[model samples]
Target: MLLADPNNPTGTAVDLDALEQFAQALSPECLLILDQAYCDFADGERAGRGLGLAQRLPNVVVLRTFSKAYALAGMRIGWCAADPEILASLEAVALPFTLTALAQAAALAALDQEAALFAQVQTTVAQRRRVRQELLAMNFEVPPSEANFLWLPLGAGRLVSPSGARGPGSACAA
Candidate 1:
């Protein structure tokens, strides 16, 4: 099973306890792949728990990307945490030197600036909440979000103007 925590587009997340319970319920043969690209924005227990989950569950692999919170989208740098055996198995079939020198250096630098990284994440979370509130005030039905982006699930053939006016026909040009 593949899951994106603090899910992209919608920005909803499952709590740690719920995640553990769900993992426990899964079959032994099931491999749970957790994509935590935007997990830095998650609050309380849901934040920074991917490595712990990977450590506790043999069938779980936690994937992380530097693209989102680290502001390294152009680098295309990513990583995964899993059981040693699982990692070894993956390494056996993986190509070598996938990371470039510049990207590697940038990733190391990003890790070194954890304080700034987290501060940016907090700012983003605040801005996200503000944007959600503004959209709600304008009568846009925005679901609660935990990521950097917001999801506007527009109803079929309904367009809402900034002044809370709803019009018929699809507002999307495409």
Candidate 2:
């Protein structure tokens, strides 16, 4: 089995060529499990990558949620694309009904407004760039991000408030 997060913790996305290379490197019979929870945030036109991989590689499985980009975080609904055997296994262990009525309705509404919400996503990305630049100017070792949140590592397990005081590690996570 192989697991891939094209957009890793650093928010770097794999292009179609790279994705194809990764898939080709694996034995066709081996399983490729892709957790693409944040994939839509990755800017680019790699529309056919996942579907292409699934169509060509029988052992590949793609799991996506009706959350995140859809902003339907409260919905427990998710979808998976894979070979029939893999889908059957999923069905066997799947819960009776993971999503409630309201969640389903919310997901549908979100889909209806996906475009408008995508503009919001673009705004968030733009803000991420501004914040990253500010952090870099302050001599922070911020990774070049391609996603929503930023991760800052405090080497000494410390924290700094806007008031300019340093504290302990627990404060950061909290």
Candidate 3:
């Protein structure tokens, strides 16, 4: 399965046992493509350390980006972990020079502060909890979010934002 953001507008994370079960079922037959673009915020317990599923499943593919956690949106820097066959397929279809020299350098630089970055993520988690609690107090059907942005299920009030109803395919860019 090609999963982007994994959960949804709900911001909920797939439980570890659930994900592992899903992967184990498909192993040796299908590849589990897990895209964790907004994973840092959703992993409240940091249960996956970002790769819990891929780590345990042989056919699982874990894709991650620096845009969310490391704040490297413009660089388009991300990595995919998969079996050798999938990796080769990806390379074949990937565009040449997909990343600029500067982008490459920046990703390398970001790696130097992994621990500090992780600490910040922990701090962000606390903030998300506070924000969710505050919103819930207002009677909004806000689910506990795992991403930087909260998931306002919106319910019958799905049409939010000052701009009126965002189209089915549109997303809140900010």
Model 3 CA deviation exceeding 4 Å by range: 43-52, 156-174
Q: Tell me the tens digit of each residue's lDDT in model 2 across 1-174.
A: 545444556665566777768777888678888766666655566422576687777878877776666777767776778989888988899878677889888877877996897897788778888898999899999876545666565576436766565665544653
> In candidate 2, which residue ranges exceed 4 Å CA deviation?
2-8, 46-48, 156-174
* Alpha carbon lDDT of each predicted model: 0.88, 0.71, 0.75
**Model 2 poorest ten-residue lDDT run:** 40-49
Which tens-of-lDDT digit does each residue in 55-130 have in candidate 3?
6666788888889888999898999877777789889999998899998899999999889888988888888888
Worst 10 residues of 1 by lDDT: 165-174
- lDDT value for model 1: 0.88
lDDT of 2: 0.71
Q: How far is candidate 3 from the true structure (C-alpha RMSD, Å)?
A: 4.7
User: Which of the two, 1 or 2, has more TM-score?
Assistant: 1
Number of clashes recorded per candidate: 0, 0, 2
- Measured by TM-score, how close is model 3 to the native structure? 0.80
lDDT of 1 at 133: 98
